[model samples]
Target: MADIAAASHMSLATVDRVLNRRKGVSSRTIERVLKAAVELGYLNPEAHEQLAAPRPPNIVFLLPMGTNPYLRLLGEKVRAVADAHSRDQPPIRCFFIDSFDAKALAAGIRQHARWADGIAFMGIDHPLVREAIEEVGASGTRLVTIVSDLPHPARETYIGLDNQVAGRTAAYLLGRFCGGRKGSVALVAGSRTYRAHSERETGFLSLIEELQPGIEVIGMREGHDDRNENYQHALALIEQHPDLVGIYNVGGSSDGIARALTQKQKSGDIVFIGHGLTHDTRRLLIEGTMDAVINSDPDQVISATLAHFNGVAQASTRNHHLQHLKIELILRENIPLQYV
Candidate 1:
């Protein structure tokens, strides 16, 4: 290995990684190492040729079946990645599963475990799902949690924003937007089964209590990330709390809440803050209905996931250095330009 490393003008560890087919070494580096090995008589010429061109690993993306605009955008981005790499890489499959059902989600994980070299999914915090992830990971498949996370040690890494910080940021923004108003605030969540949503809710409430003691949190309701359900919940909150001055959505389906606010003629009256940047959220921000949108770029999420599978050194850390994306706060005046 030392001789090959010297010949290749690379480090001994890098040469070892390439020779052992381990991750964190790029294809170009592998080729260079193999070429050096062939020249040094450490590897056969024919074997070197074969090792220089390795087959791309198959990756499966499991997204939730939902109407959430952000999730829908993620699905589209995943599909686009699959389509773009169809010719050079192994077939990439993206499946929409009932993430709310633990059994169904576990089954989906197990079903794809047979052929996937790596599996990325929006995780649900369920025992069955964790078992499936552990089982697949035990079989030498890489497991990644995206968007939402499972608090299990079996997964390789989580690729998303820090939900707790996102929630706290929302709370701070809502409190500030309300201008220290003495009124009640309401919270709407997608579902507590998703660790991301639950964490966001926890963070939001904790910060609200500490930072704005005067503002009362009326209560929290589950919207299931459904537009109609969120709409109904928002409407009910409006009726119940005539002194409502703010609302924090810990999950997606911001459009439904916007609709309810508009119907109640409380569009800009209530300080509304939610997660995810989508077409509807963009419109809401532009129209002055939403005070702020907390978001993580879908492109960054996808790139980080792919980088892990591709054996990029930066993404190989288990501490989620590369996978933990920055949180973006989008307001009406500072909304980013939309691309085609």
Candidate 2:
């Protein structure tokens, strides 16, 4: 203590306060004491590095406001992660917006960008939204896309599954599950404005035509990821197609479809595939209503976002690998015990 006080040109009392991380010590004094400690070999290198690290930036996550169980789970995970790292990491705030309204979404981005050093969102592919992202980028705020992506070059990175691959996987699973029996399939989407949903639909259709020609896609309907709406859409599809053997949902609200199938007495009869693994989907899987679920880990998504903001080398590597998340296929047999 005395040596550090002498080296830093301060009293023993000030050195004690700085070492103990007490109140009333200016940042400049703290730095002086830390530097003195480093030169005198009183502080370990790792400790010094940690103490000298820059203050974490403020970041915001813009999520969609909806009834989608998967999206709800994602928001919860984000809050939990932010709370857990409150001391050493960037302060994270989340805002739920009307994702379908392009103008509102654009406005939300611009508003949040005013105060946040970094912003991440579930991007909608709209001209206004793209323009907003570009404008925000021009203002020097870093941006990232989560779950969905935009074509704008301003986005720093994207963190989510490869939707096209997920779509093809769904097609393969449905075709194989149908046992080559000739029948038609119906597709349900939350919204085509989300590039993820559009990509998944495109991949599903292409693969079904190339490999499962016997299975025809009758039509697609937008349910906006709402349970009641998706339920109506599913029922309508069942009524319209007597030979429906498969249904692939490129978005959320799998429970609505499951309920519709149950009401129509076709739960186990039709091969059903969807995205996101939630409690409702898990129950459906156990009850033989849903065949398979394609998902990406929400925890991993949050971790990768934090890594990008922190700018640590190891975390940067993690962020690079996590740009395209690994798709997880969950079935009735392989459902994790924790989720159950």
Candidate 3:
């Protein structure tokens, strides 16, 4: 590795940073080393002594786990990471909940605070849920929320898109895509009980009202945070307003929309915009049935959450970065070609 670094004319310390993906290395520098490391079989320091000797910090990730295909991938990424970090330190103990039940999720988080060095959780809003989070904080747990955020009693750091801005940005794209075809816009969202979806809907309608006054905003349906619900609701929506010109998927169910749109006679009748960078969304975007998907870098969420526990808590990212989160407007023209 040192020989490779020498050949590349970079310091060994710089090579180490590139190998481990430690921040502070410029993207250009990282690109150079990564290009080299890909060709090299091993990273420097034969054994992961640094990570193991200094025991990686204990971080409890409190998020949803279900049949979610994208989350399944996220879980694999988090777990694929070396458990013992560098073969010397105590292994990072990661725990997860298998359902979205608020009570169960709250309980799972509470269970971790006893011995955990810190807790990083996805924020959920609701009086009881918010109170439960506060209770965890009182117990001295470091909390964090991703994608959708928790308000009032905010967490130590939020690690996802500024949802409201994301929603507004989606609206902007939808308006641009609409090309002034004055028509009603339907919103498909998860439970209004969830703050993130609620805020996105709010931002969406606000932008539509301000920018496209002629465009009608239809009242939304509660997706209930369920895939089947999104599927059923989306079909019902098309049936309700056969002339509906645009769709804003605030929270759940991209597959539901594509499944609904499939077999239809219309090719690209109405515009669609939603969140997340899931494989299902990718396929739909490529097929041209779904229109635009706004992205929030889920990997960044992982890194940000890890950062707080790793000892450098970022207060606020740039507004554009927060709004975008490496967010891409995925359309048929520029959707990712492969999941790999």
Candidate 4:
């Protein structure tokens, strides 16, 4: 029981209160804790004593495959929760789908729909994908979305950073650090098809236009969150525009941007501000290869997602609850240590 509480990262008081049905518990927070406990089978032994009774509800967590490091981190957290609960009897079964491939992602989601008491998936403001997500939620199972979310036809509250705010933050840091120099800025991002990166780029360019009108935002490359592809683009951009003052990598491509920057002749002269503090980003922050990194904790995002999921389940919140986006600005002085 304590293990479940610890892995869920909730306080012992809260966990105890929920398990005991204590008075004065907020329905939303209670639901979150109960969901975690039920998913983990914390009451499995008691249930085994009564074979005729119905078992606990099973929730299915559908996540993207770990094609990127960020997704891997996400999977690790989910696995930790699942592992803690299934000590004897298997707990909630987790399903994985790759968001990069449209067909596979949709198919995996459809296949897992039948067994799920709850659903959590990512969908942006697209037409067909959005429609599919909406239809699935109508199946009477709780739905949760991670990363980018469809604001209008929402599917449970999204639990991730505000991509646009992150973009604007990146621009602000880069512009200020560049000392108002009128040089080009490279915008490396994930796939343009990914709504999160697209929104970030939009916000970043808007800020660049308003704040540093003189700084030419060049080298807009869809690095596809591929480090090598990012490096290739960065190298090409530098070759084309030797006077690049800063690089604004608004997604996973930041590592590649840092690598490219390291190879340049005037490496220290240029500045870099990117999003997310992956392992590579953390190293770069310490080494001063990157100027600033706008990041969010994946574990925190997962916790928030669970809280929002419970909130919606209890009718206390909407699917697209405007939870405050966390933006951590990392520098050499205040680099965050990665916790596994």
Candidate 5:
């Protein structure tokens, strides 16, 4: 405690408050203590063991099942992490729910309450889903929203990017890359039902309007994160807007947009900004089909969620604020050599 306090430039009492998850301490102070403790080996296995005996909390990851590579990758990552810690940690079960269906997601959440100690999912922003989560929480099941969030206090934690900021970042990159070209830009998303997509669209549109008033947002379309669907949407947008200068894909299935742009002979001519750093996006970035990729680490998100439910003391001290997760901007040269 003394070493952590000294390293964090805080008193021992403040460190104690943060470590013990006591109220009345500022989040900033808690972050400092977490950083110091993690650096000083206080958040290691020994520390975890000292905090409490490993209690395997039964956690379920309700993920989207579809052709979207990003969602698939997220599910794979969750499974991988769960497998790695299966013997020592909680039994993490992944339930693949239908994509963009609020009623189905709510049903899944409610049905799993009997078997799960906690539930985490990429929820659609709907009243039914919100009420389901609230009911599950009331049932003593910890609720976590992954990759997107519901209204405040609906879930215990949200594990994903600040989609609004991600959208604004995409807009900034797309707008600037357009070189002040006077033309309309298209926006593609999995579905506005995903809070993340809607937030990104809102942020992107707001910034484009504020910074580049001349540039018109052609329209926002839901592609359901399906390659064929996104391809059709992008093709329609291209055909509708002969003066299209750029495109921002706030959700999955960017490969469809790339294909559409290539077919339309606008691959390099039109600036493309997208989300995720999957195999397709990586190739697109390298081949110049994609200009920039706004990436959020699925592994980190899973790790954080697991730690949160595991009663890990360090998780309490670490930052859990919305938008605190790192939003990496990847270009061709700066792209990681490995895609997984």
Candidate 6:
């Protein structure tokens, strides 16, 4: 019973309810327990023979390979959760491909469609990607877009926050923090290939124009979420616009921005806002290098993906349905205690 519980990643009480066929236990939970029991050879041979062999669900998570700690955390959590539930054979696999390469991502989808029961990925909005998603759907494989969404209508679900709202939130925070100061601002993104980043820039620029007329947006640059690239962009912004009062990073590698600010002696002078919360950002926030961080929980996103595979989160959150994740605004004083 303990082994079965462990394999199912469920509490002993929950396992008991499932094995005993209790009323409160959901069918999904019961199936998971029974499958674990059978895989562990805990079920009686005669009883096991009466039921068909358990065919574990196959789930593949395709994530971007980059220096972004947030994506790293996501991969770690997915692996941990997958390990917890795995018995003789694992059901989940995470594949990392080149960042911002639409062809590579689309190829991954097409390749995984052959074997994966479900595929979830941080999608890029592109014609080739949409074609691949549609092809995968037609092949009867479930597909979900995570973090960043694709423009395709074939994706089974999208699991992430409303990025436009997050952008607007950043604009509101930066505007309020600026206190009606007239100055130029700059925006940096990993890549506009990501719909989330583009959406964020749109909402941010729109709100800034409406609420803070004095603040001029210098322009946006593609940093590709690289430390050196973003650092260079920061330097260029400082050099071109000496009066640049603020910067909003729509993607990762915010530490690069911090370093640039420190070098220019404008760490606190320039109002800086970025996305994601890692150790680097935590320290920056405490040191006043960053004024705000708009974040989405990677753990929650992974959990939602897993729940979808388990048929636990499918009723309400289905195909093309947006499970708008919680968007958090972190300040130095209100930094979350849990780093990971």
Root-mean-square deviation of Cα positions for candidate 5 versus the true structure, in angstroms: 11.7
Give per-residue CA lDDT, model 1, range 1-340, as digits (tens): 9999998899999998788665446788999899899988999977776667665677899998888899989999889988888444556789898748889999988998787778899888888998998898787677889988886766878899889888889889988888878899999998999989888988898899788888999888999899999999999999999999999989899999999999999998999999899999999998999999999999999888887877732223555332679999998888888622
Q: Rank the candidates by lDDT, best first.
A: 2, 1, 6, 5, 4, 3
Error of 3 at 277 (Å): 1.5
What are the per-model C-alpha RMSD values against the true structure? 7.9, 6.4, 11.7, 10.0, 11.7, 8.3
Per-residue alpha-carbon lDDT of candidate 5 for residues 77-98, written as tens digits (9 for 90 to 100):
8888767773556788898988
Ten-residue segment with the worst summed lDDT in candidate 3? 315-324
Q: List the residue pairs that clash in candidate 6.
A: none
Taking the tens digit of each residue's C-alpha lDDT, what string does model 6 give over 17-127?
A: 666543245667777888898889888666554333344457899999998877887888888877787442337888899999999999999998766778999989888
Report the C-alpha lDDT of model 4 over 168-285, residue by residue, as the tens digit: 8888888888887888888887666667788889888879878998898874787766788888888888889978888877667466777777887556678878776677777777
Give the clashing residue pairs of candidate 2, or none.
none
Candidate closest to the true structure, highest lDDT: 2
* lDDT score, candidate 6, position 323: 80
Error of 3 at 136 (Å): 2.4
Better of 2 and 3 by TM-score: 2
Q: lDDT (CA) for every model shown?
A: 0.85, 0.86, 0.67, 0.68, 0.83, 0.85
TM-scores of all models?
0.82, 0.83, 0.75, 0.77, 0.81, 0.83
Preferred candidate (lDDT higher): 3 or 6: 6
Error of 4 at 3 (Å): 36
Model 4 Cα displacement at 204 (Å)?
A: 0.9
Off by over 4 Å in 3: 1-55, 82-84, 87-100, 152-154, 312-324, 336-338
- Residue 33 lDDT in model 3? 67
lDDT of 2 by residue, 58-155 (tens): 78999999989999999988888777775566788888898578998999999998767788899898899999999987876778899988856678
Candidate 4's displacement at residue 188, Å, is 1.0
What's the distance in Å from true for residue 163, model 2? Answer: 0.5
lDDT of 1: 0.85
Count backbone clashes in candidate 4: 0
